[model samples]
Target: MKKELLVLVSLFLSFSSFTQSRESEVDRLNSIIQDETVHDTTVVNTYLELADQFYLKNPDTAIYICEKALSLAQEINFLKGQSEAHDWLGYLKKDKGHYDAAVFHFKRSLSIQKTLDDKLSISNTYTNFASVYTKKGKLDSSLFYHQKALFLRQSVGDLNLEANSLNNIGSTYHTKGNLPEALRYYIQSLKIAEKLGDKSSIATGKYNIGFMYNQQGDTAKALSYFLDAKEINEEIGNQSALASNLIHIGHIYSKSKNYSKAVKYTRQALCINNDIGNAYGRANTMYNLGFLYKDQGDLDSAYVYIKKSLGLLQQFGIKNGVAACFIGLGQIDYEKNNLVQAQNYGEKALTLAREISKPEKIRAASELLYQVYEKQGQGLKALEMHKLFVEMRDSLMDIESQKSIIEQNMEYEFEKKEALKQVEHEKEIAISNAEKKQQQLIMWGSVFGLILVTAFVIVLISRLKTTRKQKRLIQKKNKENELLLGEIHHRVKNNLQVISSLLSLQEKDITDEVAKKAIMEGKDRVNSIGLIHKLLYQDDQFSGIKMQEYTQKLIESLSNTFGFEKGEISTNIAMGDTWLDIDTAIPIGLIINELSVNSLKYAFDKERENELEIALTEKNKQLYLSFKDNGTGKKDDLFASDSFGYRLVQSLTRQLNGKLEIDDNDGLHYHLLFKSYKRIKS
Candidate 1:
């Protein structure tokens, strides 16, 4: 037997005459839809309204009517009507177990509501989407949408909707078995509901908390909360909530083995459900009473109640409830030793449970069937049923395991955050202690001024001697480190020079001018990197290369290599003194070498009126390098043909994570921007 305390509370608020009022309202909307004189928008709205009212009662009819409304709204070009229709369609489709279709409609409504800039509609649609996703067993997606709805509702200052969003999120956590998170959200919702003085919402919050406590096996706490919710619901004349609370309290009594109290409360709940015409609630209570009677050894009474429940649930088209009723009947038959009849009932329950995708019911039914088959000496059949039962049980355990891992992660994050807050609090305490120590020092200094002066002089001399010794030691260590780094860089530069010399020797034996020129270019590239280490060896810092000085020296050396006179190819360097670490310096030097070599070879005329400009600067933590040549503009084959130098520049730019911009407005201009890697002392 099970109590059907809903995981998520009802969206609509309860009232004394809610059902009667809803019936009358539905009739009125239907009358409007029938009238030909009404505007298309009005007719569409009436249809949507009627469909919402019938959503729980007759979902298929609701879907049909909502479709009509949607069609008419589109014909009339009424965007608001269309959005409302889509949202209602989502609600109806979700109730009918069309989860994917329901999600589609919800998203469609959200898209339209966003275009209209209707905050309330957008928030409502988000909440509905979350509800559908939750029903589809997607807990993370459901929570995300609920959070979105909460943010939007809070921004619009709609405390009522915001509370509903919080409660819905709590339901998602509850389904995932994260009771602590569920309780937190529920309590937050309760606070908001109390602030807004929303009686129905307050009762919903209380009922959900009671249900959570019930699941936790705390009957005393659960019963107390259930009683509180019942009192409030009764005073407000909300029979639906009152009945739900009564039934749950009955469940608590049943768990504690108080059969008499359980029957009493459940029967009272049943009568109230009947009075309110709550077929679903009444059927659920009847099923619970059947199980109670069966446990008390009254098989005949159990059969009557279970049969009635099956009929009622069947009429309501609730397949899961029907499957549960069949399981109860099968158990009763098995108890009576009617093995054949028991097996038939068990198989029927299993089929319906599987059809409805109710794993718990399927497992229960399979277990009963397994017993019956074993009694009949059908070993293979019994084994098959046992396997099904075990498989379903294991599946449930796997789901629980996943949820436990998620809960552990959440707990770790929460503890980490709390630890950080505790550290901050400790820091404040430390500051307070420091202030007290300073006051104590001031008082002591006044009382022993003369003696303290003599002692202070002695301490000052000792401290001065110690500080000087430390300074001299640090200076000696720093000097040793600088000398070691300088020797390393000097050796590296010498090795590069040896390689360049070998390349020059190889160039002399080459007969082809093109091959010899290529060798010279390769030697030039090696020299550019060697120049950076040479500068590091010369400077005292040995931490970074000075770019301005390196650039001037590079231009002078390149001029001599290319046999370019002063007037023939003028090189102007305009930049402030900037220091870069070796990592950044090597790449910049190579890029400069390639561009300068390319310009000297192809970007000049016989008139000797060529100019090249190089500038470097740092701004906003970014380094900008600009290179321009007032010679011929870029030729068609300059970057189009994938030459080694052109590709190398592109590759090096990417390695630096920098941008390369080429503007051919005046001449060929290259602008590169990258993060400046400045040298920092260890």
Candidate 2:
């Protein structure tokens, strides 16, 4: 069950990945190919990339796959895809050493790229052509193409590719025997690679440096650099690079006459090439191994190895490797005393080497043929081969070439010393400029700091003057406001007294007792609010009035209005320093006034002692008020009265945030428990 579940999970994950890849690759490709707005063309390019991975490892299968991609691209009228396929085909052909076929493909790719106006791709195609030309021993053509690619790459500002182009130009110069020029370009390329931190490019640069030194006969330095490059390639696991490094190292060993070590290195390179299916690399390594065997005097082993190498070379169409292999086989036959076979092999080597226009190969083949023809008793043929051998050898080692090399080396060294001196001079100038800049910065900073401090002091002094002026204005405005409030309050109190005087006069002219009583009640209500304003205007705190003093004043006014002597009403006041703002106090005063007047008039009798008890206190944040009379107690129906005073008292009590209850058993009693309005004390 667990195994089945694991299988199901794996299938689910794989299906999901496949769906996503299909969406991104195939579906996106369809959109790009159909839509002119889209510039990206990855699907066909990706197929070519996939082919590249397998092509070296399994050429037959990868070629078929790549060809299928090309066909599909052509069929679909995908120009970019066709262009990419052509470039990839060119690379594969170049790697296999089919120069003519490679050139044909690169030319096609370049034409397509130019038609598409793809500058970068056009530059890459140029590079590919250069690589093929370099392998074909056409130094002038290789250098021309490399320079063209470099220009285009630089125009596009691709620094990484610019470095690659520089390296390729350096390689071309090296092949042309311009070691100093090659080293300069190599150093330039190396600096860019170092800046980019491209390890692969750095390794290639080191290898090129080593190869240049090897050409200069600096074996120790060459070996050190080669080993350094080899270490990096090994660490990076670049199998192709590792194979190349091994082959170069093997060449160095062979030159030093260390045949065993040479054979070992060549064999290792051969193994790498075989594993990676690099036919050209394998062929070259095999030929080197055969040469090592020849150096060790192992004729049979040399013949066998060279024979295998010649076959691979023929299969790959590598003329250089094939020519070298033929020479090796010829030398082995000559050393074994097989003159006729040696002559045959030597003749084939010369023909092929001349056809390829490789002067070095031609010289070697001519030298070998000279000995073979002499041994075979062909006198005329021997002399002709000898003359050709001397001619080719002298041309290859001409005086001008030697002088040119020496002059370039001397120039390079002189420039190196000049560059060092220039760098030191620039360093001293940089220090002087930095010091001057630092002093200028210090001087400017001090000036800016002084300006800031002066500005702050000016602003502080101005702010202090403005603040003092504002303080005086605020104080004057406050005094005026206080005096204005006091005058207004005094006018309001005078207006209430005038209204009370008019009511008294109106009451004297009246005949109805009830109307007279109503006027007196109205006058007393007006006076109650007036007294509150009197206390307000007396102080600067326009906040609240003293409720105890306010109540005492209200009762005294009521006693005078009713013509009751102080002894006519026994008043017991229990209010503390309770202060009430005008809003709550006005309603409270009215209710107290109405109740006190009612008690003094109706709830009291001449025949009995009457007492008006009023108390206001706070408990648990609630205000309580008790007003009672030792005369007559009324019914509990507060809304039952049509009398204005009775209704006013009930309405005012309801206005407060408390309820009213009448208890007639002890006396006419009013008890209120206010849960909302708070009692404030001052």
Candidate 3:
């Protein structure tokens, strides 16, 4: 489709290069218009011709002149001049990518031309109308208008316009993937152009034929036609056409696995496109280079070029080119043994291909995914993808069918014209009588249907209201439940706090050192458990608590319990938003509390500042907890039978199904490992 646009625009440029010499033309037209002897109609004609010449080089000037001409034509009641002015304005809109406005202007011109019985202008507007629809991707509507233009041109004996119409039809067929039909129309256009000795149309016909052959896998024939067209395009200085042909040749070479030739031609095309600032041409060449590098096993180079190509294609809304880039990316990832990445890219390509309705792209993506799944030993998925690939491949024309279609396409076109004439005759009769009867039936049917529809709507609205009310009630109940759960945690934390305070009071009254120590240790353990409920009640989400914040709070509580000032111990905690469910957080919190208490009691020196470090992380389904302190190493009898706190730490780790290791060489260091709770990614 992109090549069609470029090549077809080249054909138009051959006939429409008045802009190349617009300065002299503008001067001459102005002189003629200013002469009082000249007729007003001739002056108006000069204005329109002057505007056409200015259109490509200066759209604003063109629009101004067209409006001036239109105003004069309307003042003089010149219907033909007004229609021509409107048609040129439509062309300006179409050139500027304003399809809707183009359609409006074309239709307005069409009404004026129809009233004036100007068949030539009418047919020309029809062609303009079809082109705007083509640009809008409304292929069916485009074809209808194109056919109207063709019929009008044929009737009026406009051989050149008829040939252009055929070429336009061929381009539409090319877009629809009916290459055989496209080639037939191209051949008809080529015959007409040769008869008329129109070099531009002849070159365009050859290029279109080459494109069809290229799509059909005839590289030799396609290359021969492409070179012929390329020679003419070079002579005429049609750089866009030349660049597109080069790109096609490069693609053919790549498909045939001629890497050096592919790279040379593709890069040459890219350079030409860059010089011309042709974004579409540049993107197509880049995509080919991506495939080239991928085939050469340069995955990194392939990735960069393909990603850039995808960006450009997406910018231009070229879905087919975007899908091709995804395919290239998928292949690169597959080659690099990134199976998941490959599958992701391949699936995206498939989805885009399906969206754009390009079967070949769909087949390519499915085939790639099939290979990826096969390599990954996914037999069922591989089989499913293979089936899809086969279905799309089977739906395409095989070699014999393509040959048959090409051979019969001419006969088919002739019969189609006769069939269309016959159908038109019958359609008029059928539609007229059908409409008369349909109007009467529809009048009564609407009344009955409206009654039923209104009743159904009322019932549906009532149900919708009820459903929304129920949903709101359910949401309210869920909020109430969350609040109730929070209150329960808060009450449980208060109870634990009461117990901790009682232990603290008992420790204050105790005389024996062992009894005081036991009561203090009990209070610390109760405080650790109470902290978990406090977090549950206070946090926004009860599902999990951030380990870093929780650790900081737990360490601060330990410092308070041991009466250690900030200068006595410096704590560094770094977990970085790592979260754990209460199930895991409780045990980990208690373990850290016991270890911190032991370190504060015996490991630290009173005269020196102590440093404590704690970190928690989860990766690949494993949780890591680390605690280190720059204090006196633990005593050898720390794990003795009477060491209740150490024993408690051991039992807690066992409950968590975790392993605990100690490193006491320089300072007391404890590392814990266990299976992590299910982690939710943000």
Candidate 4:
């Protein structure tokens, strides 16, 4: 229903950047730094601690403070202090989008920590490295480092750090489009943070939960939690969060058609991002604004904002965002009737989306490209793009359907498969990086040829892999479903039987003969439908009703209901084994119920030997049915009545599109002919 490409808080996958007030800690660390006599490792550690205190609110100042610690530690040979400084600097740099530098510092921190044999320090460095990888869009690498930190933190019994790692891992999974896994990790992280009374972490969890809800199409619930989280973010001075919250809120408002409020909230978020120098946040917020403008039919505004967002995203090299912006630009151009520009933008978007291995974006780009191509008289290209679009759309649908089916039928059935997805994530970063580089070099030349080859090959491999991996899953599920389906049929039949019993119980109190007879007939009609279900679940072959046994049972049931003696009426059936699908069997059952009830109630008398006969057979590819009873024939027309049974017989005859004939000569007789019905497999 919704995606986090624009709405969700970036911190859902990021560490909680906000913390409780550190003024007192900052003051104490400053006091230790100013002590001229205390020039030991304590002094170096003091500088590192102070740098950590300032990092969030003042990143540049924090980096400046950490550099002094790094220098002093090198001079004094304080290895621990140097590692801590490097870790803090890496974190500070990562927050500011200085990814390459962040990695450099993080690697140095890990190197020193290896020598120091400090598990906590090493894990902390690992966490920083994970964040750097996350920002660089290397989700596989991000998850590996996050898992490493998580394990170490768990071993150290640091619930706080463990919560952070869990949240980071969830964030990585979220980026990979694995919401179930993401929610699993987020819940665990939230439980620990709530236990630790960490409001910052709580706020992070709140928004992530909201994002999950947003994806679920629960906009009101998502908005409620987002607003509550925003209040907490405000309380904790979470700067990035302020902007992130408004962007989410704005998107919701835009969905509600509250354009003015959406615009206000988004512009406010953009201003916040600009103030904080968060290029990523700014780029995304602008993208949201552009899309928002586009939705409102402010095409010019959409083009302007989207164009700007495209530039910033290009600068950051976020392929996902880049592809989305291209789609937006393409849409705007298509609206402007610039088919050529639209095609150009769609091609770029499709290439980048394919390069990034994002199916949703690929689908969007393919659709837009096909429309543009068709308009430009490129029928073959349009057809090809349309075919790809369908494959992507269908593949996504198949995966989603299978996932839902598996989840609903058997909880935890997919748990083991989750581990399979966790592998190759480390290579994900490397592969993505290499693809982006290669694509950039060859994009303007032979891009379509390259993309066509890459897309179809990848498409085939992915479908094959998905099918192979889930074949057993689906087969097992189908087996389970068959059992479940049988049980459902059994319960339905039982429920109908209960209703029939209730009618009989109610009929016992009725003193009127006519009303009692009507009640008897109503009960019998219910029984007719129930009998089909009864036959269905009683046997393994459930596709059709076995008419030979089923008709005998129906006659036996009616005879018992009417208190007729077993030998009082002689019955004959001409049909042998005829199996009709449930759809044809049901109405036929009801028709038989009405006709048999009428003969038992009105056509028969105790003075004469009763005789009944029913014939059903197929000839000339047509079904023929006959029923007759030896009794006094009524002078009145049988079907000329306002009774439900009379109308029901006529309606059912019309429903099957059959012709029916009745004769009142000597004894009542009915003949029916129908087009051949669907034959269920026996």
Candidate 5:
């Protein structure tokens, strides 16, 4: 928005020269409009031309002409002409300092442009509205509008307009006492203009920078930049800009007390202003001349120049210049000791200063009024004037203080915003870091868990392999033990068969009962050992013996051996499923052999159908074996004697880790109890 205002101000300044002839130009254009029998579009164009010519000098006339043009365009539905007329109307109103009206017209123009899709004109309207706000001192609003203009222009690749906006914003900052901010924007503008080869814009930015530096009291730096700007303007043949730069440099020299150099520059500026017919510039140059002469103590020359400057300023409606001239005249009168005239002049200056809101001029006039009253010997009046002087001085000081405070607040707010942005950025970085760490931990955790599972699988596989190996070893040892037992059994069986054959032959030759009985007994012992081998070889698993099966087979084989199958003796076997290791199996087998032989020999004494029973049971890791029979009762004294069969039974029972018992009545019963052997696989 400020940018647009600057452009407007530049345009106003540029066209200021036309103000002298503007009425005549408008009149001539009006004559042309009246004489032409043109179409609506041509008529509108003529009216717009006349409007533009009269805009600065006769805004009301310009407005009238623009409205006529607008009506014609609207009647014909000539959008382009309508848009142009609205823009001109806005410009006319803005030049007349009717900012609100100007804004309304500019907005209307902007809407039309948008409807027409005229991007360039839309930007222009935005800039125009921004300029109106800036002139009205609505700086923030102006800035907003200018930014809009800048953005649109930049989007359209209008470098010149973008730079102009930058410079305008800088100028606003300058007015707001943001020197550093202003300098930054100015430098940015300068860089863009330089890159675009826009010498005029570059020169303008340089001149602004120099002026800002001058205002900041950096005269040496300001002078350097001004010289650069002057050089560029001269090279580009921009006489008006060159003259302005020269005038500013001259003022700086004047302030530095370089009167001779000041005079030289001021004279050159004056010549340019006169050639260009710029009333305002001419007045400014004249005022500078007055100051130069006044500083040099040439009162006569100062008076003449100051009066001329005052006349020009009044004619141009330059209020600040008029106040300054009045103050100068007051100073001259006070110096001359013309107290009444001095007081009058000072009051006049004070009135003008207040009207224009020029505080420095007010302060100057107040001080001069106090001096004038002091010289006139009016002590009370002088004291009052002194008080007024002090009040004005203090008020100016307060204004400066307020301006400083405002500047500080703005700076602090800016810094605070920047700090907050930095903190937010850091927080984002921290969050990002934390997320990255969490992801890494999850990744590593998953990897470690997989490793642990893989290791457990490996251990389980190893354990299974070891178990299989141990089982194979045990099986092999069991097989070898089985083979050894089988061999013993085969040898025992062979010896038993030979003994039986010898007995048969001896029975044929000797025909003796005692010899036959001895042979048969020997044969029975050998057969008992052979029967153990038969049970051992019956099953593939040789870890332990099946006691019930072994006992049953032994009893049946013994019945066949004693030739009891056709005799009147019957044997019954009862047992539970019980198994023992080979260590216990051999002893138990021998014990069973003795019991069975005795039962067959003595149990059926009368041969009237006798019964024999054998039983084996195991519980709680203990084994029991029993034999019973029904026969003619044997005398206790006869069984009590140590017979070979009885001795064999006792020895075998002792070997089996068992105790034996016997009962005699109508039958005999024998029992043996033993600790069962627990098998441990290799």
Candidate 6:
């Protein structure tokens, strides 16, 4: 009986252990679910939980689990859950650098978010899309999408997200080498974060600002900002943030020629980053150390560090970083007088840099190539590479300068509008206070009747003076408008006459039927401009001429002169209440004339079904003029040569400083773009 009891107790203990193991398994599953699920606790959550469990070590199982969750979410029409699953899958694919798969899942998520009108989720999707584009070195598209996300975040009043978007925008600008603009946006983001008491965002912004300053050659300022950011991150126990700041500070010190301090900071950063398993951070620190050593004349150490960094970057498939490493190696070889090796490395780096759209890297590689060829006594090749380098550098600098100008203009306009609104608001408040005081005086008028009367007289006199001042300002503006109109009319008439005389002279010399036809076409164009000025002078309202009537008269006159009946050529003109100043109007008139003439000459070759459509619209401070004709399309090379007519059209178009696109798909479509000018009517 005692032996039997011992066996039963051992069996009971084994069964109890099995039950505990199953419970622990269940608990582990629940923990995974807890991390994966955002809000909904449904069967989809179980699938996501399973997916999370296998995602790291078992991608196939994770993918299957994700597919199951996706299917279940679709079955129940759970868009949010579906989007979440897709996002997770996309992130997983991105981790593997499967950009196509990642993009597909991200787009799926975006489609769901768009359908649901989930602004926050849509913003998140845009941010993700921007990340992909940035990785691809499509900076312009990335910036556009990031700005879209920023607008969405702002519209939704997502302050934290807005700050993130701002930071992302600064990063995009920084990549494009607009350091001052980047710093502006970064500082703005930092201020926003400080307002929200977001330590992480503040730290990130401060560090980025410091990095931008460092790139601008302000090492002292960069170090100050970096130290500030590092101190804050350290205080908050953010090891990753602190380490990033340290790396940036190291960069600044290296730029400042302080190799020892740079090495110290970089080593510290590398240790922290490695401890945290931040591969990207480790790679960056390594690169910094490589630069430090190179600057300190330690070529061997530089090569070691740079090669290590390149290996880490290759593991992550960072093409830009790899190109950078190649360029660094090329520079080292070039400095060591290894011309062949330098050229090889530089050419390889150049190829990769071009693929990755890294202009700075490309410029560096080009410079190296130029040097290598020059050293090899290949002067022509060196000169060619030098010229290319200069062209690329100038183009990049121009783009940066233009971008800066645009940003400055936008900011200035925004501030100006805000100031105007504030002034108007203050004026309203002052008027309200004055009215209240007047009412108070009226209430106590029995004792202060004379004083109130005197105040009223004084106020009346002041208002009259203000009215006179306003009238004078209005008169001055009207006078300026009139003068401008007169000048436009004068210039238009003078230009048209000059062209008419030139056409006449050309008509005398041309004997060929086609050549004579071209001269007459030129004469017709000259007449079109002359007609515009005639109409302008005929109208009492000098603000804008009536385009419909003006066009009708001009076309009718041209048809009569060309000996073509109005019914022979169909005219369809749809113009809005659009107006342009002389600068814009002359070019548009000439464009219209050219299109009309081209249509008349070539459109109705066989049958006389000459269908023409002309339309104009002003939107978004741009004027769009479109001319379409159902005619035999001209060859694409029609505008390639610099003929008299072509030159006239091209030069006029350029004078307007606008874009001109010609489409010959169906028949002929001519579109002209120019800035819209609004003239205040007197």
Q: Could you tell me the lDDT of residue 420 within candidate 5?
A: 36
The residue-level lDDT of candidate 2 at 172 comes to: 78
Q: What is the lDDT of candidate 6?
A: 0.73
Clashing pairs in 4: 140-425
Q: State the lDDT at 98 in candidate 6.
A: 73
| TM-score of predicted structure 4 | 0.53
Pairwise TM-score winner, candidates 2 and 3: 2
Better of 3 and 6 by lDDT: 3
Q: Poorest 10 consecutive residues of model 1 by lDDT? A: 1-10
Off by over 4 Å in 4: 1-68, 92-101, 274-277, 394-397, 400-682
Model 2 misplaced regions, further than 4 Å: 1-43, 94-101, 135-137, 176-181, 255-257, 413-682
Q: Candidate 5 — which residues are off by over 4 angstroms?
A: 1-75, 89-157, 256-260, 298-322, 337-682
Whole-structure CA lDDT of model 4: 0.76
Better of 3 and 5 by lDDT: 3
For candidate 2, write residues 489-552 as lDDT tens digits. Answer: 5666676666667566656765556656666666677677678767877764444677888889
Cα lDDT of model 4 by residue, 157-269, tens digit: 99998998898888787766666678778989999999999988988888888887786566898999889888998999898987898899898888889999999999999
Residue 529's lDDT within candidate 2 is: 68
Residue range 1-682, candidate 6, lDDT tens digits: 2233234334433543224554356355544444534433376776676566445434554676677678768877888889989987887676556778889999999999999999999999898888877777788899999999999999989999999999999999888766656767887899899999998898898888787767645678888989989988998989878888888887877776887888899999998887655666788789888988999999989989998998877776677888898888888888889888889888999898887677777888898899999999999999988987886665454433433533453354345335434544654565566556555544555345456878666666665565566556656655665556555556556666765775576467545566566557646765776777766766745435666677777767866765787598788888756556544565677777766666665566535566778888776777677888887676476666445565667777777667778888778787877653443332
Flag regions of model 6 displaced more than 4 Å.
1-79, 178-188, 399-682
- How many residue pairs clash (N, CA or C atoms closer than 3 angstroms) in each of the candidate models, in the order given? 0, 0, 0, 1, 4, 0
Model 4, position 334: C-alpha lDDT score? 95
- How does model 3 fare in lDDT? 0.77
Error of 5 at 440 (Å): 31
Clashing pairs in 3: none
Kindly list the per-residue Cα lDDT of model 1 for residues 538-566, writing each as its tens digit. 87656577888998888878877888776
Candidate 1 Cα deviation (angstroms), residue 570: 88
